[model samples]
Target: MEVSKRFEQAINKLYNAFHNDTLHPECCKQCAVGNILDGKDSWKHLSDNHGATTLNYLGQVHQNLGRTFNGYSPIELLHIEATFLKGCGYIIPLHHKNKRPKHVTDKDVLFLGLTAVVSYLCELDKRHDVMDCTTLFNYCNVIKQVSLLS
Candidate 1:
């Protein structure tokens, strides 16, 4: 049940953001990767578009160098951002007229993003999603816990 320091810190920040009303899908500094990186918006420079999964030239250079921000590679950060935005109901590569949640202030929308981000994080670490209810089945011996790389 060991988790990497990076994963633990990222989960804690994400949990706090969800509870503190600070998880905003559109804001570079308040988004999933932002909070994961301790509220820094510099990661936005890694991509041309906010919700784009592809990296820009700078991002490619960093990735090639094996540079990591808050323990996440540049490409992982992009995927995390894209996951959050999509979960929050934004069309990919966000634009002013992009389809989005009707109510940006809705907590439900943010919750969706949080869940998606958590799943991604767990997968990144090759661990079972801690929030998954299927673990209850494992306890009952009805099925195995869905751990990653099992």
Candidate 2:
């Protein structure tokens, strides 16, 4: 599938999941990273061993992009994204036992969209060696500033 279309599908899936109360932000975090590594949503696959595997997978992605992980593992990336969501005024429920916030905002949507795009690119690059991340990075940069209505 085209990257743009895949990204759109991911964003829509995430939106529906969030709106339907079927997925929490914490699970979404893992799903974002997992999708990139496993080519599908693997939120339920997170475990102690899976955490290490995710870090290794992200390292491989960075290598493929001619970049370095630079001490930032997938877990850290997830935390950073979660922090970004919090900064945008969304409450992040830290524990799975806690209920997710009832509201989502434009910022939340954009943040999740960017996450999906990044994850999708990681998976894409694994299959297509010549894929250029610059275009996707630019797309994400634009998304960061866009204001979409919930």
Candidate 3:
């Protein structure tokens, strides 16, 4: 799938953010969606409390796109959540207890970052009316394939 120029730009932005360590991992831990299933706060309260965070941005995207996990299959929701978490620097636990891999390859980070950017673009396109839906969806599909292949 050929990525549109805007999609490519989005991917670059996410890649640079990951490489520069600019993404807020600590903030994610306190995000509304991160704790959505935990029942610590009401959805409205959580959304109101977390201001200008990545999760907030994502929520806004969902609103604009009219897309949420409500109607999605459990596995699809998990994939979306996992992609969001991993993009926010949540490392997966290895087989060994209390052991985490010391390094994630740059390519892996790129894949994760691209996945995130494409996800956002998928929603953003709904509001902006700048990108072709077919092109964006195809690009997102390609990103998913690359992520899996990695």
Candidate 4:
């Protein structure tokens, strides 16, 4: 398979594996951290509790395929992930500090928002229901290809 097609297939497999509710929540966390840590017990509890699903799902997309901020408190890790998701066009930029909800830091909200976006995209892909979807992925490919030409 071509590289792009292979990437799409892997993403689809990850979506299926992640959405399988039969899987334990903690198991999802373990999948997210993968070999990034020696064991599940090594992951920060807060990150596992809050951002595991998103990290687990997206971590499968890139190499190193593990929780990037597993060493930090959940809040810190969440913030870092949120900033990354926003950079990826998954959520609005975390520019307004004052408007954030209580009990939910900017990072937490961003992570949740990212989860929704990813889930929606995965579902749309499954159903063959697409609208604005192709543009984003195509745009990314274009940028990558263009950079090579320059």
Candidate 5:
């Protein structure tokens, strides 16, 4: 489907970071929103704590002002970060006290996070999931139909 220019850019950046070992859930500069914003850490100021989905005073002001970072509202950015961290197997409001993946930098671990991020992005954009396996299921259904016909 057709994607917005911002979505295209963000996906490309995220893809590169994922393959280059630069995507880290614990790091603002390397997190999902950060990568989408071209590795900028300024988005961290939107929330009081890392992995938080709620906006702080500054974030609320920006949201009220209709401010968007790289085409995403402050609320959307917070959701993206929280979704990413959750996909990476971390509890909300990231902390040393919260449960997290044993190996933060593992390729497999990052991939899981990316998958979740992509799904959320699609949902946000009102597009089909790029990583969906429903088509495979449909194919299997087709094969079953053929077998039944045979």
Candidate 6:
């Protein structure tokens, strides 16, 4: 049930960079130009652009990620993460259209739940304009620590 440190680091760094502060210039942009460019690239291609150094950039990179507090919503980031996970082959496809199926195993559910928590945090980053870095770091750290307990 424990989430890997790598996973926690990846999600927290990304979430904080996008929401808590515009630390990464490559990751964050001040205009839609970057997002438009990102949208043009496949998710796999875009993810390659992420790195620790990406967080230390000059200009705001959150804007480059297509997050605008005035126009965008947090839920959209969840959708984006879900789509990315799907692209990464983490989420299995549901067969039935209407009624829910019991095909997903417990492990799958737990994995999804953890991913959802990270995704929700990312969404929160998109909605708010200004947030304390400590708050965001603590939130991510708490969930990551809890994952270790599992």
| Residue 134 accuracy (lDDT) in model 4 | 59
Q: If both were scored by lDDT, which would come out higher, candidate 4 or candidate 5?
A: 5
Over 4 Å off, model 3: 28-81, 86-150
TM-score versus the correct structure, for each prediction? 0.88, 0.31, 0.29, 0.23, 0.90, 0.20
Could you say which candidate leads in TM-score? 5
Model 3 agreement with the true structure over 28-102: per-residue lDDT tens digits: 332213332232223332232322223355455565676644243223333434455456355531123332224
Winner of 3 and 4 under TM-score: 3
Candidate models: Cα lDDT each: 0.90, 0.42, 0.42, 0.37, 0.92, 0.36
What does candidate 6's lDDT look like per residue over 1-150, in tens digits? Answer: 444443345455444434533322222241111232232222212222321112222213553565543233223332444333342334322222423214322334324433444555444454432323657667888989899999
**Model 1 Cα displacement at 150 (Å)?**
32
Residue-level lDDT of model 1, residues 1-150, one tens digit each, is 999999999989999998998888888889999899988999999999999999999999999999999899999999999998998989999999889898875899998888888999999999999768766755645434334326
Model with the higher lDDT, candidate 2 or 4 = 2
Say which prediction, candidate 3 or candidate 6, comes out ahead on lDDT. 3
- Looking at model 6, residue 107 earns an lDDT score of 39
Global Cα lDDT for candidate 2? 0.42
Model 4 residue 63 CA deviation (Å) reads 18
Query: How many clashes in each candidate?
Result: 0, 0, 0, 0, 0, 5
* Residue ranges of candidate 5 with Cα displaced over 4 Å: 139-150
What shift in Å separates residue 57 of candidate 4 from its native position after superposition? Answer: 26
The C-alpha local distance difference test score for the whole of candidate 3 amounts to: 0.42
Distance from true position, residue 60, model 1, in Å?
Answer: 0.1
